[model samples]
Target chain A: MSGAKRGGIEVLSGNDMCVEGALAAGLSFFAGYPITPSSEIAESLSSILPRRGGCFVQMEDEIASLGAAIGASLTGRKSMTATSGPGYSLMQEHIGYAAMAEVPVVIINVMRGGPSTGLPTKAGQADVMQAAWGSHGDYRTAALCPSSVKECFETTVKAFEWAERFRIPVTVLPDEIIAHMRENVDTRCIAEAKPFDRLKPGKPPEEYEPYSYEISKEGAAIADFGRGYRFHVTGLAHDATGFPTNDPEEISRCNWRIIEKVEIARSAFTWTEKFMLEDAEILVFAYGSVARTAKDAVLRLRAAGIRAGLYRPVTIWPFPASEAREVFREARKVLVPELNAGQMAGEIEKYLTRGCDVEKINRLDGEIITPVQIMEAAKALHGRKKAQSSD
Target chain B: MAGRRLSPAIDIEKYLRKRNLPHIWCAGCGNGIVLGALLRAIARSGFRQDDVAMVSGIGCSSRLPGYVDFNTLHTTHGRAIAFATGIKLGRPDMHVIVVSGDGDATAIGGNHFIHACRRNIGITAIIVNNYIYGMTGGQVSPTTPKGSRATTAPFGNAERPFDICLLAAAAGANFAARTTAFHADKLEDLIFKGLGRKGFSVIEAITPCPTCFGRRNQNPTGVDLMNLIREQSCGIEPGGKSEAPAGIRLGVFADRDEKEFTEIYAEMAAGAGR
Candidate 1:
């Protein structure tokens, strides 16, 4: 069952687009386990990757899936894995391992309602905070939120780019709504986009150091195994030579580099989708599936002669704080409409300037927040603003 | 066993990272001897240094990877096999070997170990079964003897220990063998044979953690533990076709030709032309 397409466009679900995006980004290996709302990505890659001379493995479990992906990545293959909330939780340890060992891997989490397997088949965006700090210890990696099917593809590619560029695990967060929703995706631009490759050791194998703290200058540049550069890789704190170390100075240097690499490259990959924000007093902050609803709500509010604008942070982590500060500068009031109970609203509150009232509309009962709910929240926010102005 | 040559004629020093030593194993730990056997096996194997990847999980035995100079990866606890599985699948041409402790392999990493055997991928798993979690201060592990004393089981363990070789054989590994740190020559020979095999091969090397395990047990020294291992083990007779004895037997428990996992995947990948 497929929809009609014009030119280079094809109808695909968000998960299907993730597969397409991974292929476009030179994904050479994939190991995954099936989970709700994210199974299609693994199923599609199983048939496609092998055909394209890439490798695919359905690992024993979620933990093994990411463990295998990390191993494949060490061999200079662009590797990835997909999962839902519970599976993502199981992958947290390896996520930390990948970060500590400086392995470039891409993980796609199709967000579902959960503290523990809450609603597997339904949609939710509650994994936003977990995406940032789920794994223990300090490490920075890009987490991208794609609102639409086309962005699902583009954002998947972007995730790979940042993973390779920063030599760290990058996560693509797509809520269950976007994961299952099908739409016609124009893939011409994405197809032609050049994929980023991880930096290889340019020096002789004898002098090559697999890790270093040149965060402002370069990301992790490593040599693939079997290429004659037999450097050690470990999850423990390590020195520039890639061997484990206990020296306090060396440990500090290693930790700071992995965290700062993403911060240094933030300007290049950080992005936001703004709709009619020039002189708007009420700013609507949202992302993922909620962002799409927010857009609809913003349009309706504008049609009703109220200045409401939608601001969606495409790159959710390395959290666009500077841009949030700039965008929230002119707004008198801000409204966050999300699936979770104020997960990202609290983050938005962190960046909003003084005197700006932040209102949150949360729905956690396995349902999407409708445009009407957002419009009502915006009206209330506007009424509060008017009352304050009159006083 | 009085005058046996534990060290091989090959230059194992070339295989070691001299700067990283002296190793972190305890004063009387048998891990050093096990590491010596592994080095001899690797030295005897025909594979080039660059083509071998030594992966280990967190443990005293896992620290052996750091001392050697191959493409070593000291990963998180209980994930060395999973990581080695990926490396083998990624580069079928590379010789991937995993070194994990008893608790790391048979407990936390049990699922991956059994699955790897079922898949029959070409990975040599040298499970250093010290009977307890030596790195974590002598906690009773999956392979700890039912009546053994550990820090976690001070009153003696009630849980039965696992026959790791039998477990590997039952899980469908192409090759499964058993030897001890005291049988250093046999340990090296078994490891070499495991490396030469086509699919998933397992060698459970019973070694001693004198500091953790032996301190609480009757055997308080490495020499005492070595003598205890020597006395308990029985060698398999040549041309024996009977089932393995219920106790520890020092020989190959299983060996058969099987279609390897990586080769099947490689064939499919090659056939799936762009």
Candidate 2:
């Protein structure tokens, strides 16, 4: 699909670009069961994949979708699956398996309202925590947030790279708006960006320990079946031998590798966009589609002679606390306008400093936090800061 | 009796992980015999050991993957077939086999099992039906016969058991068969034949759980359980089988030629390229 012709902008929904992004990232296998808003990704890929020599399988359920993806990843192919809230819940079991087995697979969880199937078509950022802690036990993973159609395509490509880089399942969170909203997308840059494929063991079967940590600084090599790597892989905690082990010290050593490898790469994996923070006295923190509205609020406050900036974290998990620390250092107040009730704001509060006052502008009734709402919240904070500084 | 000594012709030691010697199955447990037959089948199937992948869900029988020297995957409860289906589809070159228990394969993983059969994926699913959940201490299972006692069914199992072979046949599998662990030679042959088939194959290998299910009934020892199976079961004629009796059948019931899932998928890929 890549050519040396002229490039132009075209209108495509975020979900449509998600499929395009996956194709561009060298994804050859997609196993997904449909859910609302996110269903278009599967539907589009169903026809697109077969035409491009890739496989698109509609599994019986959500659990099987990720199960198949994890299964496919063992063959050393980049694989992906998509779902919404309830489907994401069912996928948690296999997500844990993918983590424990160190399988590189990408999961696209289109955020929708929920404690349980709360809103099928509406957007919410409630799954941010779920994406981090949804799977059981101790493991470290990366979750990327895409706020627009362009980011959907770009971040998905990056998600595959991150998953392959760390040998962990990476989540790409796009909300209902970004998933369905049609926007101008330029496809030229994607053709040039290279996707990272994890290293495979060059060592012979005799010397290969599949879970051995000494191979690469990023992660260990995963040898494919029939290539004579003939290794044992399981979900239970194991030693470097890739077999189950109950030893406390070896378990810690095994556990720390998955976490340390990802943690070491955090600064490189973390992506945050900052706007107008050079001389700002107030700040608004947001992500996903809500970040777009937060930007509008920032612009409105700036136009009104109020020094306010926006910190939009493109990488949500691995928290981006370091990036936020830079913002908190300058702004006297921080406003977090989330679609959920203070989920991201609660996160920001954890890394938040002593002098900065935090204001939460949350909407939990299956509605987006509008720019007007964020503008009002930022203005109120700006006014308070202006008052304090004048005194 | 089904256990009457039939000399095992193949050398099974080389296929096993010698370091993990002395498996976890109980002394009289039939899992060992079934596992031995599977290893022999793998040895004689003409497929390279590296080209074969054994996927299993959680259970006593599911531990087979840990003992074998191959590309083994130990998955969650009841999802072995699902994961195997993925492995078969992803590579389309490897021979994927699922080794799981009745409770894991037919109960919790029942939906995935039927769908895999329906898709007719090129994977052989070997289901070990021990009539009771052995790992959890004698709980009722999907293949537990009616009126049988279990820890879950103290008085008696009021529910009806599933006929795994028939279910596979109904779900459009190309091959389906049932045999007991005691009939090691026949079961191995059946598995070899199933692996030889192009599409999905389900072999319900009835294994005795004397420590769990056998003592619940009067058959306390593993030998007693095998003797009971020999006396109570009937051999089905080719293409002649019924599920009503809930007894083991000692031969292949259905073997047909059908276009497998991966073959069809490959055809699409080739056509797409053209």
The best candidate in terms of TM-score: 1
Per-residue alpha-carbon lDDT of candidate 2 for residues B192-236, written as tens digits (9 for 90 to 100): 888888899988888889988999988899999999888777877
In candidate 1, how many Å is residue A322 off?
Answer: 0.9
DockQ, each predicted model: 0.80, 0.73
Retained true contacts (fraction), each candidate: 0.89, 0.78
Model 2 Cα lDDT, one tens digit per residue, A154-198: 899999988887789999999988998998877675677687877
Which regions of candidate 1 deviate over 4 angstroms? A1-7, B1-7, B236-247, B270-274
Model 2: lDDT of residue B98: 94
lDDT of each: 0.88, 0.85
What clash count goes with each model?
Answer: 0, 0
| Residue pairs with clashing backbones, model 2 | none
lDDT of 2 at B39: 81
Q: Candidate 1, residues A239-290: lDDT per residue as tens digits?
A: 9998889999999999988877777777776689989899687899999999
